[model samples]
Target: KSAVSRVLSGKPTTTPKKKPGSPSKLDERTKRRIVRYMQANIGVTAPSVVASLQLGVSPQTLRRFLNAEGASYASLKTSPPLSDAHKASRVRFAKYHLDNHTDFSTTEWFQGQGVTTTEWPSLSPDLNPIENIWAYLVKQVYGPDKPNITCKAQLRSRLWHAWETMPKAVIGNCVGSMTRRLTQ
Candidate 1:
């Protein structure tokens, strides 16, 4: 019968939804463990995740999952200057977090040597070519796409891979253009 006839007959118009193809790879317990570990260690890395948790997945897979969970690090876009009230709140926060919890003997030593800290304009030192290495690694570590990474040693190996794999012309061009850029 036509759909108009079915409507006139008062039959249901829609079909039932299909079941999912399969269950998720990670069960509830595993999901909770991952979330707890990340919370406990604010700076958890991908290599560490695979090594410590033995999740049997690749680092790339974990990274994609974490990104889906909205746990990926964000790139900075803009920030306003702090007002005096904000500065005072920051001072209070430093006092609570630092004096109470931090071992700042190094800070004290600097103070004793009269190496006083001063406010400076913001700087993004990522312009240096070497900084590219760190940016690449950060994407691998914090970006969390893989799952089988065994240890920090894997991270070190990847570092060497990056260093070895970069094209020569990129570095050569940077160096070669420096003089011309400075002359301008």
Candidate 2:
């Protein structure tokens, strides 16, 4: 009698009923098309892409989709002019690297340090693979799908994400290429 009563009792099933149809506003085909468009035009902003493609999706939706696919947007900004102190620090760093690592043909000794005095260029982004890494970092941080960074905090967060996610092989390749670049 108890089993019969329990069976007769009106109760919802333990398993939730599945909802029919997709939750996404755009279909898979449309999304794929948008991705293709983005791949071709890397520097194009998301808003411009939406406008051009006529995807009929909101900017926020597009951004979310693109971000999910590892795309972000960032504007090019000019670096601030280097201060005298910053310049001096750069010089010191360069001097340290040159002194510790570089092999000079001349047997000149400076301040008993066995280091030759060499003029380090003020800026040498071409010779440094770190610059390439920085460029890669910037691209990764500001993906084609991501929104433009509006504040320092956002920039820092994105930068951290890029740094953490960057592959060791990429860094090694950049460093490896340095010798070839130096020779050229």
Candidate 3:
């Protein structure tokens, strides 16, 4: 009775106890393949990945394994439509660019000019070079060492500053990549 008490009252062992369950159906090699598949296909949900990969694992099991391997899933929210005035401003801006640049008169450029004032599907950011530009501007405006922007006024000021100070070449390069993007 004294020995039992001592054993029960003693500090718990530091070593981890084995979980009570069957071993994982996925081996390390299969897990690595799943990880690689997930990496290759970003923005995919856990269930979708499991179905597409034909991994023969349950969604819950795949999710658990992915979580253990530091994988995360997120669903992107769609942006709301632009107001009429915003649409008008976009049209004006595109017209100004198109009218000024006589050299940019290709069929592709014309198609781009036509779409400038239109509302695009929310999931099509990859089709828009402006998205890349915005990402760059965000990085410049709110870099790791920079102080947080606390208000709308501060954010607007920072955005303007970042835009004005940005190299014309950078903007030009982004615009120039549109053809390559379209081709791809």
Candidate 4:
């Protein structure tokens, strides 16, 4: 065997070769199109979006992409439709947090790897399926064609009612999805 490079010493190490794999089905242009469509039709379901876009990709694939983009698709009742200014403000807030929260050392030290932060935020929300349960509870609190929430007391009462009355099956399904989510 030949001598190995003294990586422990001051000698520089060679860069690792790229991993071989099939390219992604969705290119940048196609992905941008899908995002724009989903934004415009925010209320549409993932399977419906897959059908509408006819992108030859499964709903799961599209959902994975959206998750990576920091978009929430949880079935929650909207407070009100956001205006352009509200949307812009939200974007700015997200960007500011991203800029401030990212660990500079990870970027400086690592190359050709995925985004790294101080915390493993990528394994959040989805991994913990209680997020879906929370969305369901919010929807249950408001109900269909319900009056707008007026005060903190009223909201609290409705929230309590929803939680107490939530179907056991709904809660069970959300919890059960954890294994499936982990596989993905």
Per-model TM-score, in order, reads 0.31, 0.37, 0.33, 0.34
Residue range 44-145, candidate 4, lDDT tens digits:
888998899898999898888888989885686768889999999999988756856566576666644665544555535457678888999878878787
Model 3 alpha-carbon miss at residue 132, Å: 58
Where in model 4 is the C-alpha error above 4 Å?
A: 1-125
Which residue runs does candidate 2 get wrong by more than 4 Å? 1-112, 120-125
Q: Summing lDDT over every window of 10 consecutive residues in candidate 1, give the lowest-scoring window.
A: 118-127
- Each candidate's number of clashing pairs is 14, 7, 0, 0
Residues 9-88, model 2: lDDT tens digits: 86533668788966888799999999889788767787898899898888888989988988767775658889999999
TM-score for candidate 2, residues paired by index? 0.37
User: Which prediction has the highest TM-score against the true structure?
Assistant: 2
In model 3, where do residues sit more than 4 Å from their true spots? 1-19, 77-184
Candidate 1 segments whose C-alpha is farther than 4 A from its true place: 1-22, 74-184
The lDDT per prediction is 0.71, 0.81, 0.83, 0.81
Residue-level lDDT tens digits of model 3 in 56-119: 9898999899899887777766887899999999999887675443454564686787855343
Better of 1 and 4 by TM-score: 4
Cand. 3 Cα-lDDT:
0.83
The TM-score-based order of candidates, best leading, equals 2, 4, 3, 1
